[model samples]
Target: MFDSVLVAVFTYNEENKISEVLEKMCKKFKNILVVDNNSQDNTLKRISNYPVKCIHHKYNLGKSNSMKTALDYARINNFEYLAFIDGDGQHSISDLEKICNKILDIKNGLVIGFREDLTNLNLKKRIGTKILNKIFTLLYKKKISDIQCGLRVFNISEKSIKWESSGLQHYFADAEITCNAIKNGCQISQIPIQTITSDKFKGMNILQGLYLLIMIVVWRVF
Candidate 1:
């Protein structure tokens, strides 16, 4: 069991998938947390069935806020590492396990489970990622294949990689973390993982992609 590691699952109306995710995670991990964004569905009730700590919001905070809440919980509870996995069934639990195992061997760093293939994703998602990848390479001088993958693990004690992404950039939080870590000269490792793509697992749209492109430059300079 990962005694010092906290696995946080963020959910919103994920009733259909939450129970399964919690069931698997609970069996594998001792310390698990679920941050629900006032899900109107049975997501909250589904989480209650598992033997994990849960925080239900009064209103629907964005996905990014749930991330902040999870990070705060990890910090307050003194967890050495925090791992994020979506409540939706898109992320691979095996990949998350790989990240946790990898982080344990690192002194301090961020571990991201980059998707191994993108042929099944939407065209916009593919194009958007390519543009962002180009800019990220130019600005950060690092070649990361997937900048917005949510299946990630990082040391909670390392403040340099703490991100300040807000608003609709909820989808861009992972990207911000990568850029911040690179700028601060922190260790970052990307492990290839399989992803299940679907409409429910929405990647950023045109506007969010454009905003993130601009913010990547802002984060690099200021």
Candidate 2:
């Protein structure tokens, strides 16, 4: 096991699934941080029983803000590594064990989890991801299969490497941040990971996906 690592989960009304996610993460990482965006449900109460560090935001601050809070916590606590995962139980916790060693080897790069399956995902999401892969390749000259995957590992000491995006920009923050880190002389690698399709999670609903696409176009143009 590594010396110190913090696993962060961004939650917004994920009461139905947060408990399992937290339990799995706590088993491996020990220090789990939950950044709740004022969830109305018992997500907070359910998570309270676990030894998790809770950062409550009175309003919905978007995913990037949640991530920013996670980074801040990691940096402040002197945690060597920061791992990001979904609070909706889509990512397999066992994958963490398999990739931890590989991540440690990279040392100065971001370790991204590339999901094994995409055929079950929504067609629009698949198309959007394909477009993003093409755009990232053209812009950053890198081949990344799972650019938007939530399961990723990074070293907090490499803060200067990536940009903490804001607003709807968070939808593509994973790609942007990784590219930014690459441009800043940091290496990035992909590791094979398992994925689950859970309808209960409810992230980036159909409407939000459309909105995010519009934002991407606007951002890309100027």
Candidate 3:
């Protein structure tokens, strides 16, 4: 078990999937934190069946706030690293295992998982990912294949790479955290994970993609 690490699973109306996800997560992580964004279903009840720490929000506060809550919990409890994964079951627990291993192997490091192929992604998500990746490379001088992959692990004690974790970034937290980590000189390692099937594309809309495009530049400037 990873005693120094806290594996956080973010949930938002994922009752249909949480049981299986939590079942797998509980086996890998001793300290599992479920940040439920006021799921309107039985996600919490399923979570209770597992040996995990659950924090139910009064209302849905978006992914960024959920991330902030997890990070705060890790710091307060003196965990050295914070790992985040989604509860949709799209992200593989095996990939998360690699991330946890990679983070522990390096000092002050952040491991971001990249999908090995993009052919399965829908047109909007596939194209938007390429455009944002190009823009991120231009601004940050780094070519990260997948900046928005949900499965990742990072050192929580390293303050410089922390960046600003609070905002209205409904779906931009992954990219924001990645760009900010690179901008602040955090050690980053990207692992190739199996590309998700098209059926798993949950929130990559035109508006969210546009907002992430703007935020990519915003994080670079301020």
Candidate 4:
């Protein structure tokens, strides 16, 4: 684990996956932060056993808000670098070592993951991702293979990283964050990441996926 790195995770009803994620995370990141979005299950209890710093939310504040909570906590606590991953068992802990090592070198930049494949992605998510990739490449003149990958590392300084989590309606938090970072002269690098697809997904459907796409297009055009 890197003493200079603090890893954060956003969780909601992730009781089944949080333990495994933490076990792996401890291998590369000494400090772990869990921001629970008011899970209705045993997620909080399960994560309580770990040495992680837990931040409980009474309500579901969405991913961007939860992530923002992690960032703010990291900044205030004096963490030099802040990295976050999904709580849905999609990120690989081994890849974190490489990403972190590289990011530490570029103290004031961003390091994001580029997925190797969408083996775990459902039909709607796969289609939406492809469309967003095209749009990002066109608009930003940068080839971003995975605009939604949860694995990313960035500096903790307020001036170095500015997040507008208020734009939660866009549902493209990763893309927007990266776009803003690049626009403000922060260097960005993409490292390859492995995908862990899930067999079951609750509440998310094709319609919600479509809404996300429309929102992204609207946000970009305007």
Candidate 5:
């Protein structure tokens, strides 16, 4: 079992689903951390009874910042691996276990849970993800099935610890992380996962997608 792996869930006002997600995570992983992005709801209260570490931000920072917090925590605690899953009830605990097992087997690399079913997403999101995935594949010269899958496992080596992303450009943070990992010569692998679709977990709008495209181009240029 991957006992030393720290499971991190980055949440933002997910009072309705956070409790169930935490309960499932705690069942499989002994160490779990919840990084709350200054939620206004009773999210914190709902998770109070759970035996997990909680980091409440002063403001509603985006997912990138929340992940940075979790990464720092993992480093300080000397955890061997860091597993990140969205606070929304989309990601499956069984998939999480598969990711952890992949990390253990590989010993080093980024293991991403690639959602095979994309029929649930709207047409715009589906197109955007397809284009982004193709772009990433060409840029990194690696087959990246999903550029924005939130469920992932990373080996906490010194070299893999360094990551940078803008709080303003949160939409592409997942892509940025994957790009950095590939650029640094880390092995990237994918495991099939089933996602629970919800309207609450929909992708960005047209303007956000355009901005993300520009940011990705800029990221690749530099």
Candidate 6:
């Protein structure tokens, strides 16, 4: 699977945890790609010695753009699967094997790692996530446990399915991708995953949520 799959880690100022995360990933997968969004810290320097490919953005693009970069790379390189993990040390490396195994089993479905615990998040975030989840279910006709989960595995071989909002700066680009895939007749499934809570996990603000709501409605209608 390592030969056919590419593990992409998206990072932005994860100096404290990038080294350990990259080390763990390198140990498991031979082809690892780190898409860095111009980290202000020593994240790039820290991962410089690792046996992985690094793509540094000239500016600080958002997570969605970073994902598109990795997706394009994986597709061009002819990788059958693309696994995404965050570099903030929240997503567990132990779950990668399970995710990869699930991807192998599903073959062509979008496998998302569902984070079961929302107790660590604030009331606003939890409520917002719940509302967003409902909206996703209504729009995509698929029940998504965690639409914003950063840990996911995608089968890049489905070239016909394209991500509509890949260029969007909104946090809901993950939702957009999932919805697009589902609308394009792709099966979606979720696997329970363990996440390390952090204060840095502040999700979209009220304005962003409102914007995402508009995006969802527009996508639904059209």
Q: How does each model score on lDDT? A: 0.85, 0.75, 0.84, 0.77, 0.83, 0.82
Tens-place lDDT per residue, model 4, 1-222, is 677778888888998998988877766677899999899999998898888899998888887888889888987889988898887777788877778888887776888898878756777777777887887778767787876677998877736466564434424577667667655677888999887775567533667656655655654564
TM-scores for all predictions:
0.95, 0.87, 0.94, 0.89, 0.94, 0.92
Candidate 4 similarity to native, TM-score: 0.89
Lowest summed lDDT across 10 adjacent residues in model 3 is found at 160-169
**Which candidate number would show the highest lDDT if scored against the true structure?**
1
User: Model 2, range 145-177, lDDT digits (tens) per residue?
Assistant: 776778888878885445556776665566556
Of models 1 and 6, which has the larger TM-score?
1
Q: Write the per-residue lDDT of candidate 3 for residues 1-222, one digit (tens) a residue.
A: 888889999998888888988888778889999999999888888889998999988988888789889988998999999999988887888888888888888957789999888888878878888898888889999888888887889888776555454446667778878887888888889998877562455686888688778878888998
Clashing pairs in 4: 120-197
Rank all candidate structures by their TM-score, best first, as comma-separated numbers.
1, 5, 3, 6, 4, 2
Q: In model 5, what are the clashing residue pairs, if there are any?
A: none
Model 3 clash pairs are none
Cα error of candidate 5 at position 104, Å? 0.8
lDDT of 1: 0.85
* Residue pairs that clash (backbone atoms under 3 angstroms), model 1: none
Off by over 4 Å in 5: 158-161
What TM-score would you give candidate 5 relative to the actual structure?
A: 0.94
User: What is the lDDT for 181 in model 6?
Assistant: 71
lDDT, residue 222, model 2: 43
Total backbone collisions for each predicted model: 0, 0, 0, 1, 0, 0
